[model samples]
Target: MKLYYMPGACSLSPHIVLRELGLPFELERVDTKSGKTERGADFRALNPKGYVPVLQLDDGRTLTEGPAIVQYLADLAPEARLAPPNGSFERAQLQAWLNYVTSELHKSVGSLFNPSMPAEWRQATQQAIGARFDYLSSRLAGGGFLTGPRFTVADAYLFVVLSWTSHVGLDLARWPALKAFVDRVAARPAVQAALRAEGLA
Candidate 1:
């Protein structure tokens, strides 16, 4: 399998999962801005959305979207317990958290990066995101991970989203639980390896 990624992007979530599962895979860098891979292949041909985190399977089929890719990869190695068993309540809860991070947190943080975003929208998003952070802080207060004692794909996705706080000038220190959660996730060897591989360490 091969993963097309831009350094420090959402792709880092699946990249970390791959390492956690000890899966042997290849990595190809993508220039999302130009819609080209390092080899000069058109990224839009692989993923019409024109983004990073595109995974090509051995059979030549492809997968896009960070949440889907990470879940698929996690299922590949269930013994790793990167996600809960399929169809279980824990699994559903994991999906719930994933959806929250993707829709509620990820999109809001991403919008702040747009220089031309309207002031009203930016302020609203920041306020909304802050509330979400507060919610997560409470959820994490008793946590080992998002779903339970074990780390899951949801944590991986959330970690990537939270990592964007610095880029948007949001100080995580306001929420001690979240600040500690970031420290905890960053301490994982798989995450560290992914960070170093992406030149983000």
Candidate 2:
């Protein structure tokens, strides 16, 4: 397996998942901005989306999309409890959260990352994202993680998305619970490993 990633992007989610699962895979850094690889090969040859978090299987096939990739990697190591078993209520809840993050939070952040976005669309997205963050802040109150009791894939997505707050000058100070959530997740050994792997720690 080869995980293509950009430093501090959504790619970190799958990277953290792989580390948590103790999966043995190779990491291939992708410079998404340049559309090239560390080896100077055209990255478009691997993923036409020109995005990171593309996991190339040993068989030459590659998986795109962060949510899908992390879930696939989690299913490969169920005993690690990275996610709930299929067909369970927890699994449904997890999927719901994943979908919410992907469609709502993730896409909103991605829209803002685009320098070519329409001014009105960008402003609306910023307001929408702020409301979502406040909702998350309330839900996370007095809890250690997103699900309130255990670590799940949602927390990974949440952490990665919330990490973007700094870039937008969105103050996290009011979202004490969410801020604490970031601190708690960062203190985890697996998350630390993920950070160190990316030279963040």
Candidate 3:
């Protein structure tokens, strides 16, 4: 499998999952702005949406969307317990968290990265993200990962979004549990390997 990604992008979530499962895969660097892969293939030909985190399977199939890709990889190695069993309540809970992180956290933080975004809109987005952090910090205070003691794909997704805090000028320090969550995820060997491989470490 080859994962097309940009350094420090949301693609890092599945990259971390692949490592957690100890699956053999290669990385293909994508220049998002240029819509080109490292080998200069037109990214739009592979994915019309023109985003990072496109996974090309060994069988010549492709997968996009960070949430779906991570879950697919996790299901491939259920023993790793990166996600709960399909059709179970626990799995549904994991999905809920995944949806929240994708829509509420990821989308909001992503918008702030737009240089053309208005200042007032940026301020509102920041405040909205702050509220999300507040709620997530409280949920995290009770827990060991989003769905239980074992880390799930949801945790990986959240970690990638939280990582953008500093880049967008939002301080994780303002929410200690969320701040600690980032550190805890960072200390994981799989995450460390992903970071190092992506030149983010």
User: Which candidate number has the best lDDT?
Assistant: 3
Higher-scoring candidate on lDDT, 1 or 2? 1
Model 2 scores a C-alpha lDDT of: 0.86
Q: What is the lDDT of candidate 1?
A: 0.91
**Model 3: lowest-lDDT 10 consecutive positions:** 141-150
Residue 101 lDDT (model 1): 89
| 55 Cα displacement, candidate 3 (Å) | 0.9
Count: clashes, candidate 3: 0
Native-to-model Cα distance after best TM-score fit, residue 67 in candidate 1, in Å: 1.2
Instruction: Specify the poorest-scoring 10-residue window by lDDT in model 1.
Output: 142-151
lDDT of 1 by residue, 42-109 (tens): 89999999988999999999999999999999999999999888999988888999899889988889
Q: Model 1, which residues run further than 4 Å from truth?
A: none
Residues 52-118 of candidate 2: C-alpha lDDT, one tens digit per residue: 8899899999999988898899999999887889899988888888898888888888667777888
Which pairs of residues collide in candidate 3? none
Clashes per model (N, Cα, C within 3 A): 0, 0, 0
- Tens digits of per-residue lDDT for model 3 on 54-127? 99999989999999999999999999989889999989999999999999999999888999998999999999
The runs of at least 3 residues in candidate 3 whose Cα sits more than 4 Å from the true structure, single-residue gaps closed, are none
Over all chains combined, what TM-score does candidate 3 have?
A: 0.97
